[model samples]
Target: MFLPTTIEEVKKLGWKELDVILVTGDAYVDHPSFGVALIGHYLVSKGFKVGIIAQPDWKSEKDITRLGRPKLFFGISAGNVDSMVSNYTASMKKRKIDEYSSGGIAGKRPDRAVIVYSNLVRRFFPDVPIVIGGLESSLRRFVHYDWWSDRIRKSILVDAKADLLVYGMGEKTVLEIAQILSRTRDIEKCKTIRGVVWWSSKKPIDCHELPSFDEICLDKTKYAESTRLQTILTDPFKNIVLCQRQDSRYIIQNPPQLPLEQEEIDNLYLLPFERKTHPFYEKIGYVPALDMIQFSITCVRGCFGSCSFCALTQHQTTHVVSRSVDSILEEVRILTKHPDFHGIITDVGGPTANMYGSSCFVRETKGQCEKFCLHPKSCVNAKTNHERYLELLDKVRTINGIKHVFVSSGIRHDLVLNDPHGDLFIKKLIDFTPGQLKLAPEHSHPKVLALMRKPSVELFLEFKEKFEKYAKNSGKQRYVVGYFIVAHPGEGKRENEHLRKFIEEKLNYHPQQIQIFTPSPGTVSTAMYYSEIDPFTKEKVFVERSLKLRNAAKANLMSLNSAR
Candidate 1:
């Protein structure tokens, strides 16, 4: 059942007032892939009346006040993707299509949707506690660089004027907040919850202090230092509390929420999700994002790859968590029963598909390792086994009504190459994948690859050769699609030319998946983009800051096939 979006629907449920209302920047889809729905359903399961207002018209009070405000708090999210990224392109051009919106139309959500939505709610309710979360809020919880404005902005908690901010996967954090507000009705008592950030007049004792907003604004070096500190302290095992001054007030961030246990994550995915767009969007048109993921299943959570440009490490963290095989198979059975079921499961993995059931024994016992598990070199303590994931795939293919099961999520080739059972896993993956097996090599130049924290191009070449041989042996015409990024930190005209030559000679194909890098908030790449200094190495790096040059590099790569 869909959560009530209007007062009439709320009254039909015999509820006088809802305990929580979630506002999102995307159209309402009651699917687990949608953040607002997953959170709303979880809150409902905890015996609280929950409602949602999606993509509310920010200019007026109509949609914001339709549900009449909640008793506990208002939850705000900028949808699955950050709002600014959703609204604009890497070149700062306005985007024409929003997959999360009705009919793939753009302009439904404002630029900074989190801040806009929170302000709208405050204008109407005036007294309701506001809690902001999701990808946009999570990455912006600290004073970080904003590519759109090309300046350092204070923590989102300050700009949004929100009462509290929840970071990371927020299921447990939000639940705790709801329960506390229900019993005590005091927002002050919810400050110490893990995975939450709140503002205080004075800094808390024993907390790690980051550079003040003013200092970072004036000194780019200080900004880079702050990014370095935040990255190391991200380990939940460290239990580090971070504080930064934002003008007169201080923003205190508690330690991240610990990774969910196996049983906990297992039950979270099994929550009652209709897995379809709400009837409210029927007249508007189909939501493009829902169509892409309705039949797909998320078999894992979190990633350990820690790519410099990727935000998974900041939001999902480096802890790798996978759902039980039984839970995944059960969900597949349920998907087969859906009215839209077509015997095909589009995807069955998380941030990195092959990392499912993989873990680091050293970190599991001691804590986060000083080095990344898969970068530079595979750590000795890291477990690179793919046997359990292979077993799960074999069992899934035998289920009735399941015609095809594909791993559409990003696959870390380096991890597969290091795994003992990589050969068997690759053979099985090739069979499950449809026409193309997608992999992100990012770039070909060693210097650029190093800055991006991706493995060398040699690893990709090794994997591609094996993939082609296996596909030929199996009589399938499968292809390996390589994804690359242009104009990342340390990439110049020389680096771009190197990438073009490698694609033409080594890859031997026209690249279809190429992107101009966008310096989003709370990433090492973004810190480098803003400061022109590597946060880890503390050395100066070349940055392509011209928008025209960034676009030209992508155009040059895309035009390679025609030129050939």
Candidate 2:
């Protein structure tokens, strides 16, 4: 509850002058925040005058008047709305989980339960229109099994139970809602807008489909071996299928993917972003003095790299489209001119750095490649032109006062090693520059890597060896860093032992740079974790977060690399 300075002061501020108020259910993630701010900023941009109530605990009505109770419309999120399964559970799918948990941060009021927050708001602001969106609610738009809680849960619809649910991208929908409400359209009139999920009498209705999109029907007969810009842009799956409804309901079924338009590409670069600096900076109390920043430009929209243990293909689909070098240069110039410009660029790359303005087949396809080459061991376009990326790097390096631009973005090494100029391209980096090249080998054992559908351990080793010899030859000493996951559903202590031995026998993995595996949402690994199958070995396995074992395992990678 937000306390007004005093009852007299609160009363003096004149409690009821505003037309509408917006409430959100997130405790700011401090800096380098996520999409929550995007909606808020957009609302502000439209001139609706909004107020933010940071992480209000749902149990109390005492704090509802913190802003003096003007007619309000609330926005809520399920706190990054992720689905997590316990590493220890019976049948993995036998858990029923809902409610926000404050992410276990103290002083962080338990605003973890979005349902509770909305219900409380109803009790206090009964006539208020509460709209819910964000990952949790969006993903939970329909009934589905809550693996953590093990039961069929209703759409986040009946639960946090707001007036309406805004699923999918909130940009256009939110914009329309703002316009209507700002012009004094009845709250009921909002039901007319497309893209909004609303409650009519009792059932949920996904109103209209303004712009339809095509879905890449995964079934081979329906799906092409390769996807293209127009095919995806005109996707037919405008409705998003809520949890487990028989037919596609609530979901856009088929909504448009961002098309590869020159202007849209340029627009993406203009959006605001904050760096995701490490947490330890705060622990050491050095946040204020730190100058690190994270810069990102989307290289492409979809990924067709179907590692059965993956979801990029399912969620984002696979179509490669990119921004022009000229557009990218403009953004870089903007960053460099910022008042805090420090000649050092800590990170510059995309979803995969080696894949800029590239498709599986180039010359033959006229750059309009349909499939990122589903054929062989190499990327869709390995033998084609590699000059574009090299040129991009050179242009970036020449930026006014840049000291050293680091490619912290992970690189798809398979693409790097196969490109005609692959080895030489990297050679140029060693010949002139600073930074580590990120390779996500994921796992080492051939069986395990095969399970991951990622490059083989042998492939990674070959790449590393070349990188090492290149470094030695050029007299450059920065290292080739690798990121691997452990305790996966298929990775038993024995399999993990193989990983340990492989690291020792091969490219020494390092501790400082290793990422402990956490089954993040929307990844295929999560399915395996949910099913309790290692997939490759088909053996029952546990996705363990062995802190002590992980520490030791990471030390093995670091010490071995240091010695070499």
Q: What is the TM-score of each candidate against the true structure?
A: 0.99, 0.67
- lDDT, model 2, position 390: 71
Residue pairs in candidate 1 whose N, alpha carbon or C atoms collide under 3 angstroms: none
Instruction: Name model 2 segments beyond 4 Å from true.
Output: 1-33, 42-51, 57-73, 78-117, 120-123, 138-155, 163-170, 176-243, 246-262, 271-321, 359-386, 429-434, 513-516, 532-564
Instruction: Kindly list the per-residue Cα lDDT of model 1 for residues 1-564, writing each as its tens digit.
Output: 889999999999999999999999999999999999999998998899999999999999989999996999999999999999999999999999999999999999999999999999999999999999999999999999999998889999999999999999999999999999999989999998999999999989889999999999889999999988888887788889999998998999999988899998888888889998889899999999887689888988988888899998888778888899999999999888989899998998888877788777766656577677777977777676588887888788789999988888998888888877788878888878888998999999999998899999999999989988899999999889899999999999999999999999898788889999999999999999999999988989999999999999999999997887
Clash number for each model = 0, 38
Alpha carbon lDDT of each predicted model: 0.91, 0.51
